[model samples]
Target: MRRAIILFVSLGLALGACDDTGATGTVDAVADVSADVSADVSADAVDTVASDAEVTGDTDAPSDTSAPADAAADSVAPVDTGPPPSCPEEAVTVYLYEDGNGASNSWYDQPLGSDDLPLSGEAVSITRPDGGVTAARDCGPGRYGFLDLPAGAYLLDVAVDGETTSHNLGRRLPRAVADGAVKLVAFGDSVPAYGPAPWFPEQLETLLAPFVTVTLSNVAIPGSQSSEWLPGGSNYVNRLAPHLADADVVVFSLGGNDLMNLASDFEVLGVEDALALLDDLDAAIVAIEANLLTIYGAVRAAAPDADVVWLVYPNYAMSDRWAQYLGDYQELAATLLASKLEGIRERMGDVAGLTLADMYGSLDKPALDAFLWDELHLNVAGHRYYAEEVFMTLGGVLVGPPTSRGVHRSIGFRP
Candidate 1:
C-alpha cells in the first residue's frame, strides 16, 4: 500500500512536470506541436503570432496562430558532450555501428556470450575517484561511449542486458575501444594452464567473448618447475619471453612443483637426511621465492604495463587423489603458504605492479577435492571456477555481454 501511494505520488509529479515543459509529452509534442509550428500566421515570419490566451497562460497549449518559438527544438535530441573521454577516434570516424538501440529498445535483455546480437542500449556510467559520475551515450547496436571521464581510474557501471540496477565492473575500464581485443597471456604450471580443452584461461576467453575479443596464449606446461620460467630456465627464452611484449594481461600459478620433490624426500631419506629436508625446507622455500620474484621480473621487464597476476596452488593434499604423491601435500601446501607470509618478506610485500592471487588460501577445501583431475591438476569444473575468480581478482570484469564485432578489427564478431 505504501509503495502504491508513493508510486502514485511520483507519477502525478512526473505528469505535472511534463505538462509544464512549454511542450506536451513525447506523443503530443511530436504530433500537435509539429502542426502548430507549421500553422504560424503569414504576417511576420512564422514565430510572430501567438494566441493571446497562450501567451498569457503558462501551459503548453499552442496559440491558434503559431506554436511557441522553442517548439521546433522539442524534436531534437538533448545536447551532450559528444564522445566519451576514452572512446576510440576510429570508432567515431568510421560510423560502423548503428545508431544505438534507440529509446524503445534500450531495455532489451541479452545474456552473456550473445555476441551475435547487437550491443544493447544498456545505461553506462563512469564514477571518478572523487565520485562524480558521467553517463553513457545511447549509441549502440554495436557502439557505446561514455562522457567526461576524469584523468584517474574510475569505476564503470553498466546496466547489464535489461537489468534495472547498474553493475560495477569491479575495476577501471580498459582504454582500448569497446570492441578491441584484449590480449591475455597465461603462464606458469598446470594449476590454471591445464589444457586439452576447457581450462581456466580458455573459459575466461569464452566468458568475455560476447563483449570483447580475447587473444589468449596459454604457456603453461604440466610438471613445470617454476625454475623453468626463470631467467636461465629451459623454457624461459623460447616459450615465455617472446610473448610478453604487448600483452594486456598475464596470469600464472607455480611453486608446487618446485617444492614437491624436496617434500617427497622426507619419505625416502630417513635419519639425518630426513631431518635436513625437515629443517632445511626454509632454505628451499627461500630459493623458490627468489625464483618467483625473478620470474615476475622477467614478465615486468617484457610487458612493463601489463596486468600481471600470480596464482598460488590450492591445497592439493585435501584431495584423496593427492595423498599418494607427496609425504603430505596438504601440510606442505599450508606450510609454504604460511612461511611465505611470515619468513619470506619479498613474497609478502605490497601489490606493487604485480598482483598475487591466493588460490591456496581462498579456494575452499571441498572445492580443492572436487576440482582435481589427478594428483595436482584441476579438472574442467575447477578450471571454470578458477577463471571466474581470476576475472574477479584482476579488479572486476565488465558486466554486460561483450561484443562480437570489433570496430578497427574483425576478430570476435559472429553472424
Candidate 2:
C-alpha cells in the first residue's frame, strides 16, 4: 500500500508538469492512470490521487477560470485633474426708447418731448462682431446688456411693438482725441436734425460710445435746402461754425428738399408739358451743384482738419405710393436726380478729406414703404435704416486705411 501511494503521488506530479499542454493532456493522463493502476492498487490510493489532481485545478477546469480575476486586477482606472472652464464677462449696455406717435411723419422734424420714452418688455438681440448671436433678452423699460463680451464691435437690433431698429456698437475709431473721444458735427437739412424717433446722430452717438467718447453737434435745419448752407449763409457760418473748429468729422445730407421743391411745380403741370418742366429742372440741378460746391468750400474753410462726408439724397420716387403719384415721370426724375448726385459724389472725392455716401440706391420700394412716413420724409424705420447706412459709412471712414481718405467706397445700401 505504501509503494502504491508513492507511485500515485509520483504520477500526479508528472501529470501536473504536463498540464501546460492544456486540460485535454491532463484528462488523458488521468484516464491512463485509472486504466493502468486500477485492479492492483487499493481504491483509497486511487481516490487520494484523484483528489490531488482536482486540487491542482487541471482536471475538467474552465479555460478562463482565472481570467475574470486577472482582468479586474489589470483594469485600474486613471484619476482626473484640473478645474473646469469659466464664462465670459458682460461689457455692453443699450437703452430702449419708445416713440409716442406711430405715424409715418418725419420723426426728425418732431419735438424732443415725443421721444426717449422708456420701453419695457421688448426683445433685444445682441450680435457679436464674429456674427455670433450672443444674447436675445426681454429687456425692461430702460436698458439691456451683454456680459463677458471681448473688447470688439457688436450689433444691436431691438424689436418693439412690431417695429425694429438696429444700431452698431464698437470701439473702432482710428483716431482718439486728448479725452479719448471724437467730435462729430452734422450740418444738413431735416434728415439729420429732427426726430420723433432717434435720428442718425443720436443713434450714432450710442453706437460710438462703446468705441470712443463722441461729442455730436447736430446743426441740421429742417426746412432748409442745400442752397441755405452756402458760404455767406448763417446756417453754415454761424449755426455750424462754432462746432466746426473742434470737429473730427463733418457729415451732411442735403439736395432732397431742393429737388422736391422743384418737383412740386412740375407735378402740378400736365405730362404734355414735361419736356419744358425738365429743362427748368436741369437748370435747377446746375444751381444745386454750384451751391453744394460752395457749401463744401465753406465747410472746408471752417474745419480744415475735419473729414467731410456728403450723404447723397435718396430716390424718394422709389416709394410705391410716391411712384404711383408721379407715374412714368417718377423714373425719369429719379434717374436724372441720381445722375446729378453721382456727379456731386465724384466732385466731392477730389477734395483732400472729403468723401461721398451715396444713398440713392439704399432703399427700394419695399424699404421705402418700411422707412418713409411721407413721400420725402423718413419715419422711425426709415431713420433706423438711414442711421445704419451713415454709421457704416462713418465706420469705413474711421477705421479704413488713411490712404483711402475716409472714403466708404462701396455704393450699395447695406444694413
Candidate 3:
C-alpha cells in the first residue's frame, strides 16, 4: 500500500475567486488585435457589420438622415490590462485532435499559418509577449490553428459560434528554492494535448518559467484509460515512468474513458446442480482503482519526492441531454472518484513524504470559466490555475533555489 501514494500525484488546488466574464461586453478585447486593427477588422468587417445601411451610413457621408450619431463605438471604454499580473504567456500551438472515441482527424498549428482556413465565427487573435497579433484559424469541427507567438505571456480565449464562452490565461513565476524545476508529464484522453491548446505542454513550460522552469511532454494517445498504467494491456505506466524519473513533480489526470463492463463483474446464480458463473461488475472500478494504485507506486519509485497530483474532471452539471444518456455514469464515476481520493488518502496516510492535491472541489465557479477549455479539459486559464496550485502545494517553497539532495532523489527512496 505504500505504493499507493507513490503512484498518484494529487496536484489540485482549492479554487480561488476569479472574475467571471460570462457577459459578452465584458470580455477582453482580443489580445494584440488592436495592433493590426485595420487588417483584422477588414477580415471580419462583414461579420462585424449588422447590415449594409449600418456600414454604408457609418462609412459614407454624414448619416444626418439616420438615428442620432452612434455614440456607442465612439464612447471610450478604458483599456483593460486584462486579468491580474497572474495571467501567464500566450500559447503558440494548438494540436487539433479528433475525439478519442476512435475518430480519424488531427491538425497542428504554431502561430503564423496559411490564411486558407476560415476563422471560427468565434476565432480570436493571439497575443505575443511583445504585444503582436496573429489570428487563429478554424480548420473545421475539431480543427484549430497552432498560433505563431513571440516569447511572452498569453491567454487562450474559448470561442463558440463566433463568441467567447470562456477564456484562460497563464501565470508566470520565478524559480523557488533549490533551483526547483517542475516538469509536467500529461497522461490521459485526447483532450489535454488535443486541439485548441495543442502546444499545451509548451504553454505550461512558458507560463511557469523564471520562478520554476517547467517542462511538459505529451503521452496522450487515443482511447487511453487509467487501467493501462503499468502491467496492463496498454502499458502506459511503463512509457510514463521513464520520462518522469527525474522530475520534482508529476501530474496524472485520467479515468474518463473506462466505463465498460469487465470480465470480473458477471454473476450467474442457482448453483445446486448447475455450475454458476461469478462476476463483480463493480470489479471493473476496483480494477481501475488498483491500476491507479500501480501508477502512484511507479511514479513514486521514479520521482521519489515529486508530488503526484491528480487533475480531476471538471463539472458537467449543465448538460441535460448527456445527463439522460450518461447521467448514471457521471454520478457513479464521480462517486467512485470521491471514494478513490479517500482511499488514496487512507492508503498513503502513513507516508510522511507524499501529497495529494484535489482540484475538483478546489476550483470555484468564477475560476471554472478560465479553467475549462471545454466540458472536459482545461484551457489556458485552467492550466495556469493548475500551475499555481501545483506551485503552492509542491513547488511553492522551492521558489528560491535547489539545494537539498533529497530534492534530487526520487520520492521512492527511503530517507
Question: Which ranges in model 2 have alpha carbons more than 4 Å from their true place?
Answer: 1-173, 177-179, 264-273, 328-333, 349-352, 396-415
Query: All candidates: CA RMSD in angstroms?
Result: 28.7, 40.7, 22.8
Q: Using Cα atoms with residue i matched to residue i, what is each candidate's TM-score against the true structure?
A: 0.51, 0.52, 0.42
> What are the lDDT figures for the candidates, one per model?
0.45, 0.47, 0.35
Output the worst ten-in-a-row residue range by lDDT, candidate 1: 403-412
Candidate 3 lDDT score relative to the true structure = 0.35
lDDT of 3 by residue, 3-65 (tens): 111111110000000112232221122112123322221121111111112111112222321
Model 2 TM-score, all chains together:
0.52
Best by lDDT: 2
**Considering lDDT, which of the candidate structures 1 and 3 is the better prediction for this target?**
1
Model 2: per-residue Cα lDDT over 157-209, one tens digit each = 44444321111111223334224678888888888866345676776676567
lDDT (0-100) at residue 316 of candidate 2? 54
Give the C-alpha miss distance for residue 250 in model 3, angstroms. 1.4
lDDT of 1 by residue, 1-415 (tens): 0121121122223333444564345324323322422121111111111111211111222242122233221211111111232345322111111222211111011112322344345454544434355665655444455443322233345444321110112222243224266778887876766532567898877755544567889888877877888887668788887788878778888766766655444432223332344345567777778788888888888887676777655544334543333322333323333333323322433324555444543444444544455445555545655665565444332221221111111001112
